[model samples]
Target: MDESTGLTIHKSEAVALTQNGGLAKAIKPLTKEIHLFDTYVAGVSYLKDKTVLQEIKIKDRLTLQREDNKFDDKAIVVLSSDGKKLGYVPEKDNIIFSRLMDAGKLLVAYIIEIKKRSIDYQQISIGIYLVDF
Candidate 1:
């Protein structure tokens, strides 16, 4: 049963689950963990180099931390590969992602694509992957 989409998919019917349209569609079996949905980034000003964001590796691992200082109750800090401050998880999409991260779920983020936009939040986009044990 997937919590996000509320779809119950048995392990034996994983293939049919994907065909039936659910979170299973986003899932891919990779070893013991399932590769789940992707997450995005916001607050571009905190990024080290907005101009060079596109240069980041596509599948490079990132870090997520709970931030309660000046943001929402679900604020999640998105960090770079080398432990630098990249930005944050977008507010609208941070709820589930933050909760999952805080619950000690193995969630991973990668640099998917970076769009050069005038608005800050519209700048860099990060891809989120989940691994459950």
Candidate 2:
């Protein structure tokens, strides 16, 4: 059942059970492997499931720069067609880059903020922030 906050406490408890310690630690590798497996499966499915839709071409490719000036092999490109700007997609972040090559018109390229939080043994939470595309 949904709680007052529209969340199921039992589900949260289940996730807590699989947290960083205890059973979670033991099965962490397995969880990662499963995640990779699922990604591979979904990628294959998308490739096999071709759409009978029209092709949309993007005008230009945008360069993604990191705030720290770190060079990476990937960048996010916003693509569009019909001379109208469309939404941006994080490139290389998606499994099917080639498929989305001609989906929309090219727009702006800028770095976005990324945040990560972690809890240590003492249960103190630390947050790390980065500007990445």
Report every candidate's CA lDDT: 0.70, 0.27
Writing each residue's lDDT as its tens digit, candidate 2 over 1-133 gives: 5766886545566577666675756555553111111111011112222231123222222231222214423333232222222222333343233223224321232222212222211111111112122
lDDT of 1 by residue, 25-98 (tens): 45545324355656567776666576545445666778878888565889888877776777888888888877
Instruction: Give the clash count for each candidate.
Output: 1, 6
Q: Mark the regions of model 2 whose C-alpha exceeds 4 Å error after superposition.
A: 1-73, 95-133
Candidate of highest lDDT: 1
Question: TM-score for model 2?
Answer: 0.16
True-structure RMSD for candidate 2? 21.3
Give the Cα error of residue 98 in candidate 1, in Å.
1.8
Residue 28 Cα positional deviation in candidate 1, in Å, after optimal superposition? 17
